[model samples]
Every structure is written in structure tokens, then in C-alpha cells.
Target: MAKASRRKSQSFLHGALILTASVLIVKLIGALFKVPLTWVITEDGLGYFNTAYNFYGPIYSLATAGFPIAISRLVSESCTRGAYRDIRRIHRASAPIFIGTGTVGFALMVFGAAAYARIIGNESALPALYTLAPAILFSCLTAIYRGYYEGLRNMYPTAISEIIEALSKLTVGLSAACLILHRGMKEYEALGTVFGVAAASRDYARSAVLPYAAAGAILGVTVGSALSFLFLFCRHRLLGDGITEENLKNSPPPRSMRKTVSRLVRTAVPIGVGAMAVNVAAMVDTTFLQTRIHNVMEQNPQVLLSMYQGMIPQINIEAHTVPNFLFGCFSMALTLFMLVPAVTQAFGISALPNVTAAYTRGEKTHLKKSMEAVLRVTALFSIPAGMGLAVMAGPVARLVFGARPSLPITSHVLVIMGVGAIFASFSTPVNSMLQAVGRVDLPVKLLAVGLTIKVALNYFLVGIPQINVLGAGAGTLACYFFLTVAALTCLCRETGILPDFLSIFGKPLIASILCCAAAWSARGLLSHVLTENLSTLGGVGAAVLVYSLSLLCLRAICRDDILMLPNGQKIAKILEKHGWIR
Candidate 1:
């Protein structure tokens, strides 16, 4: 029994590390994809693309979010019990349900794309919306297969599919956008427009060109998702044929379709709602925040128009670009990259089996310990990463995106959003824990409370012209902070696991602050001796070194913490030999 438990723990760690590495690679490739995309499409074009995405976010979540998790949970539980036949039953039962929801989602996006775009205050986004509509169905199909593989304790397929999807998006999306822009440029030249001109003409040129380019860029989403579905479908057929054959030989008669769907809906609702909560908040921003800004501009157009005349270039650039691009960087760079892997990426998925096993066995002590350890591991990674990201936002953005006119605001928002990243990371593991423990519904309820607060904050803050983007970041911070606190409180109450807040969070916070200070000073000093980009890079290198050494000095994290990381054993042994583990 002891050996089995130890092996399971090792397997858990191994899977988590693999998933983490894959997710990090995917994010890096995604960032690489976005940088050149931003250059090709520009901020204005990105605005339309983002608008289409924001509108699509919730519906896509509805289609894909719950079913995968529900299926995974059902499948994993059966696998744990050696009920291979039940696993087949569950997958067979889920197929029709998945297809139905996915179809509905696809239809909504395709048929309602025009109305959705117009209602969101960007009729120009309709082309992008239409182009991206098929992604809903494609993504949904991929999710069901991915969930099945995940339940079987496999991560490679999902990881490989993600890489393929990113590659496809990068290759196809960029090519399409460039081609569209080239055509647009030809059209403008034929119409007697000069290449090198004043800001006014450039603004006009962009208005005519960017919409088509944005649509072309968004079409890549549909293409990539379709390819991902194909990859997963083939992989599933290849790997599961023998299992399917065996299951069919021993399988019971099919359950009633109504009963199967009822079970699926019951399982999917909470997981789906919880999973989609963040996207829902983003949709709220898209629906309300953008319209509010438009209203503010309209009410004071004369004043704004006069102000723009003196700063024509800056105004033109900002007028078209700032909102969408800024939000994308915040969502992708900080939210997806900096925060997600801590818990939601692979950690949560890996935890499902152990957590569910312990909970199902009614091993209260084991479950509590498992939950706390997960939380601690999450904090050990997320806290310093968040702080480092905040302080290094400017340099990081410049490195990734190059210096653009809107960069200062983008960097500022990134810093502010970094606070949200900490809380967001915290929320994911806790939510996952809750789901594993069968209190999945609570997270959705708690998220609702947070979303209400977020909406209120965004309404007031985003309306202020000076605090426009910053306000959105601030709202995100507050929303996630509320959810984190709420989730933690509920988790402890239910599990009788009061986490050592000071040990898990406080030490890391202190060390990270010190690291940030050092990083800040390094950036200032390096700037005097090198170009801004080079200086930022130097400062980042210093930050990493300082933070790692500081962790050892403060003992914020120890041998156990290091051992949780990939290549952890060798690294821990070296640290121990060096007297760094104490």
C-alpha cells in the first residue's frame, strides 16, 4: 500500500511537470505568434479581432467548458475503480450530449455573428466574428477527446495537440493577415494614397485596411481548432481501439439517453460555470466597458476632437489600437502565461486523481494534506512570479513586442494586472480542489459574487478617461482577489484544512518584494549604461538570480518545495550539499 501510494504521488508529479512544460511552450509560441501579429494587424486591427473574441468567449465556454470536466471526472473515477467498461459507457453516453451542445454553440456564433458584433458596438468586427464562428464547434470537439485522454492519466496528446494548434494558428493566421494587408495596400495605392504621409491620411488608410486584415487573422482560429480536432480524433482512435473492443465485449446494455444526458448535465453545469466564470467577466467588460467609453467620448466629442487635433498621430493610434491590444497582452501574457500553470494548467489536472481517490475513500486527513500541499506548491511558484512580472512588465513587453507608442500604458496595466495574476493563480487550484472534493457548485456561486463586484468596479473606473485601461486591470485584480479569498475560506471550512498562510504566502511575499526592489534598482542603473531593451534584459536576469538566492536565504521554500519542480531531486541534492536547503 505504501509503495503504491508513493508511486501514485510520483506519477502525479511527473504528469504535472510534463503538462507544465508543454503549457509553457504553448504560451511561448502563442506569445511569439501574437507579437508579429500585433505588428502586422496593428492595434486597430487587433481591436476588431479582440472584440470578436470577447463576444465569442462566453458562448464558447458554454459549449466546451463543463462537458470535458464532467466527462473527465466520471472517467477518472471509473478508471480508479478498475471499471474500464464503465469508462466506455461514460464516453459513449457523452458523445451525443457533446455533439448537441457544440452544435448549438456553433449555430449561435455563425447565425448571430452579425448581431453579436453590432450589439457589442463594433459592426466592423462582424467579419472577424464570422471567420471565428466555426472555432466554437472545433474547440468543443477537441475538448471532449482531450478530457478522455486526461482521465486516462495521459497528458502528451493534449500537449501535442496544443502545440500543433499554436503552430497552425501562427502559420495560417499570419499568412492570411499579411495577404489581406498586402491587398489592402495595393487598393489604397491604386486609389492614389501615398505610403509616406501625415497621420490623418494614415488613420484613414488603416480604417479601410484593418477590418479585412482582422477578419483574416481571426479565421486562423477556426483553421487551427479544426486541425487540433483532427489530431485528437486520430490519436484517440489509435490508442483506444483495443480498450473499446474489450469494453464492448463486456459492456452492459446502453443506458437511456435521457438518463445519460441528465447525468452529464448535472455533472457539467457546475464545472462549466466555474470554468467559464473568468470569461464571463471579460464578456461583461466587452459588453459594458467599451460602450461606456464610447458614450463618454460622444458626450464630450467636441472637447476630445479639439484635443486630438494637436496630437493627431497619438490620438489616431490610440483611438484604434489601445483597448483590444492592451487587453490581449494582459489576458495572454500575464493571466494565461504567468498565472495559469501554477494551478489550472497541469497541477489541477494532476491533482484530480489523488484528490478524488482520497476524497472517495473518506480519508479526511489524507485529503486535507493533499489539498494544503497543492496550495503551498501553487504559492511557491506564483507569488514570486507575479511580483517579478509586475516589476519587469515594461522590459518584458518591450522584449516580446518591441517598443510601440502604446507600450507605456500596456506595461502599466501589466503591472497592475500582475496583482490579479496572483489571485487568479490561487483561485484555480482551490477551485480544482473544490471540484475534486465534489463541492464544484460552490466555486460558480462564489465567482458570481466576485463578478458582481467586478462589474460595479469596472463601470465606475473605466468611465474615467485617465484611468481607462488601468481601471479594467484594477477591476480584474479586485474580482480575482475576492474569489481567491472566498474560495480559500470555503475550502478550509469544508476540508478542515486551515492552510499556514504565513508559511505558504507570507515568506514568499517578503522575499518577492525584496527581489522586486533589487530588480527596480538594477533596471535604473543598467539604463544609464545600455539601451532600454538591453537594460531591461539585464535587470530581468538579475531579478531571477536575486529571487532564487533570496528564496534560499529566507527559507521561504526548502528542499521539499524544490523537489516538487521538474529536475527537482538533483537540484535539491545540490542545494542541500551547498547548505542552501536549510
Candidate 2:
């Protein structure tokens, strides 16, 4: 029994590693595309993109209704039951629900874009708002398709689709902005006009020079992406004929449509609520803090909101969302992407089946042992990744925000947020483990409590004068810390598979400490070279290299750890060939 639990841990790790590699590509594409988009739209226009996105994101989540989460659980359970055919049917049945709901969600986003801009971003923002409204359709469809494929234990399609989505969005969004630039409008002004809507106190004079070039680039991309997803749906019709024939021959006496719908609704609602509760911080933080941070920078209070809305999320997405998309779609939704496949792919191919056998037998000792292996494996990856972000927070913030974009408030917030990320990262695997074990409701309660604390803390922190945005970051850290402890405890209590407490807590702090030292040292080393054109690039390279080496040398992560990933063999082959290993 214990070994089976270990197998799940290994499986989760394998998923996470594959996801990391795939996610890296997705993040790169997202960053590359958004950079030009940001240049075109201007910081203020970026605000509009954020506003439209915020308005639709929650809806998108609601439409998804935890489809990926529910699908994965269902599929895994079926696999456990050896009902392979049913797992396929479950995936097929779920997609239309997502599509139908997603279509309505997209329409709502389009209709509400202007209103959202005025209410959330600024009255002067209309261009960015409208331009990004269509993004919702593309984004939602992309997610649904990926989720469907992931439920089937396929990762490549999801990975490819994410990269394609980023490529499409970038190609379309930027090409449209570039046409404005071709007209001789400066980059900032052209982009502002493109993504920023016409609002009160609008600066029309700045945009007057550029001819209106709608439907050619950005809009076309949006339309094309929607069409592409429709094309994928077309293949389903072709595939459906075969699927229906197979199902008629093999399916358990045709369940009533009402029963299927009711089953999906019942399972998905809880997952959706839990998913939403965890992410509530993203939607609420800006709205609550925007009014208060106004005093600190009355002339441009939107700075903090912009950072949270446009900047921080955009940066974090490279690490989280794009990876999430890649993992969810191709790797095995978020849970498998983040945990199972990566670990299995890394540690040992035989590890998972052995663990699974142990779990099947319900050997409590083996489960503990398997969890121990998982704890060790998770750290080998997380310690380095989390530390890299924490230590290099300043450089990362500088690179992401651009050299001059890091104000005292912004600078401090980025570093502090990295502090929060360390805790949040660990909590993720723990939460996923609970979901995998079919204890979904437990995570929901934990997340609800943490979110409530975060919200309450944000209000109190925002009231303080000097703390300002730092308070928001602090609140986030508090939330994650609370969740990590609570979730870890709950999982241990329920399963009796107590993970290595030291690996969980001690490693993150050590990684953070190493990160801080390496980052500060790199900053000192790069201080002379960092200025004007070279600052962001120079600082980032130095910090990344330094932090990475420090972690390896300190044994925080090394050859053995690398061998634990799905990609471990390749890594091991390279290292051993190079004599980095015996």
C-alpha cells in the first residue's frame, strides 16, 4: 500500500518535469510575444489588456467548471478500475460542455470589454480593452482542447497547442501593432491607440497620425484562432463516428443524458469552487488595493494595479500559467504535469508501477516510503526553481519590468512576492496529492481559509502608509504559508504518509537564503556593467548562473536529483559522458 502511494508521488514528479520543459517553451513564446506587444501598447495600454483579462478570467474558470481537475480524477479512477473505455468516454463527453459554456463566456467578455476597461483600468483605455476581448475565445478554447487531450494522458498536443496559441496571439497582436508603427507613430503611441480604448481624458491627438488598421492583424489572429479550434472540433465529427460505434458495442448500458449531466455537475462544481477560491487573490488584490495605493503615487496610482494586473501575472505566467497550460494539456493537466509524469520520467521508469502496486496492496509502510521518495524528489526540483526566483527576484523584476520600470515600490514588491512564491510552489504538489487521492473537498476548505486570511490581511496592509504594495505581497506570503502548513498536515493526518518535514520546510528556506546571497552577490558583481542598455540582461544572466551553481555545489540539487526527472536519463547520459557523474 505504501509503495503504491510512492508510485503516485513518482508519477506526479514525472508529470511535473515534462511539464517544466514544455512549459519553458510556452513561457519563452509568451515572453517574446508580450515584449513587443508591451512595447506597442505602452504600459498604460497594457493596463487595458489586464482589465479585459481579469473580467473574463473568472468566467473562463467557471466555464471550465474544473473540467481538467474533474476529468483527471475521473480518468485516474477509471484506470484504477481498469475501465479503460470509460475513461475515453468521460473525456469525450466533457469537451462539449466546456465549448458550449466557453462560447457564451467569450461573448460576455466582448460585450463587457469596454465597461470593464472603464471600471477597472481607466476611462482612457478602450483600444487595449477591445483588442484583448477576443483573446478570451482563443484562450478558453485552447484550454478546453488541451484539457481534453490531457485527460487521455497525451501531452504533446497540449504542449504544441499552447506554443501555437502563444505564437498566434503574439503574431496577431504584435503584427497589428506593428502596422500602426509603420505609419510613423512611435511604438508607445501606436500601441496605446491599439489596445487602449477611447475614454474620457483620452489622448486622441497622440493616436491621430496612425490610420485605423483594424481586422488586419490582431483581430484576424483572434478570428483565425477561434476558427482553428473549430477545425479541431471538425475532426471530432470524423472521429465521433468511430467513437459512437465503439461505444455502442462496449459502453455500460447507455446512461441517461440527465444522469451524465448531473454527474458532471456534481463533481465539477466542488472542483470549480475550490479552483476559484485558490485564485481569488489574483482578482481581488488590485481592486481592493488600488484605492489605497492611490495616496502613495496619486499622480499614477494604477502602477500597483498595473503590476498585479499586467506585469506580475504576465511574468509569473511564464513560470506558472504557460507551464500550467503545457502541463494541463499535454502532460496530464496540472496535477500530472506538475507531479506524476515528471517524477516517473525522472526517478526510474519502474518506480511508479512498483509504488502503484504498493498502493494497491495498501501497505501503509510502503506508502510512507513512497512519500519519502516523493518528498526527496520534489525538493530536488522545487528547491532550485523557487530559490532561483527568490534570489534573482531583483534581476527578474528588472528584466520583466524593463530596466527603468522598477520603482522603489515595484522593486520591493517583486522581491517580496518571490518570497511568497517559495511557499506557494510547495503547497501546489501537496494540494494535488490530496486531489489525486480523491480528497478534493479538503483542499477547497484549506484554500478558502487561506484566501479569507489573504483578503483580510490585504485590507489591513493597504491601510498602512509605508508598507503599501509590500503589504499585498506580505499578505500573499501569509496565505501561502498558511495553506502549505495546513495542506501538508491534512494530507499526513489522513494518509499517514508523513513526508520529510525537513525537505518541505528546511530546503525552501535554505534555497531562499542561497538565492539571496547569490543574487546580492551577482548584483554587486554586475553593478558596474549594469546601466542603460545592458542592465537588465547583464544582471539576469549573472544571477541565473550564480544561483544555479550555488544550488548545485551546495547539494541542494545535483546529478542524483536530475536523474529523478523524466528527462533524467538524457541529463544523466550527458553528465556521465562528460564525467560530471561516474
Best by lDDT: 1
lDDT for residue 245 in candidate 1, whole number 0-100: 48
Which lDDT value does model 1 have at 275? 72
State the RMSD for candidate 1.
Answer: 4.7
Per residue, candidate 2 scores C-alpha lDDT tens digits across 111-193 of 77666544433433345446545655555566555554444444445455555655776677667767754553443344544
Off by over 4 Å in 1: 1-10, 191-202, 241-260, 301-344, 558-572, 579-582
Go through the candidates in order and give the C-alpha RMSD of each one to the true structure: 4.7, 9.0
Task: State every prediction's TM-score relative to the real structure.
Answer: 0.89, 0.73
Q: After superposition, how far is residue 226 of candidate 2 from its true place, in Å?
A: 2.9
List, residue by residue over 411-461, the lDDT tens digit for candidate 1: 787887776787888776788788877887998999989999889888888
**Candidate 1 residue pairs in backbone clash:** none
At residue 30, candidate 2 shows an lDDT of: 60
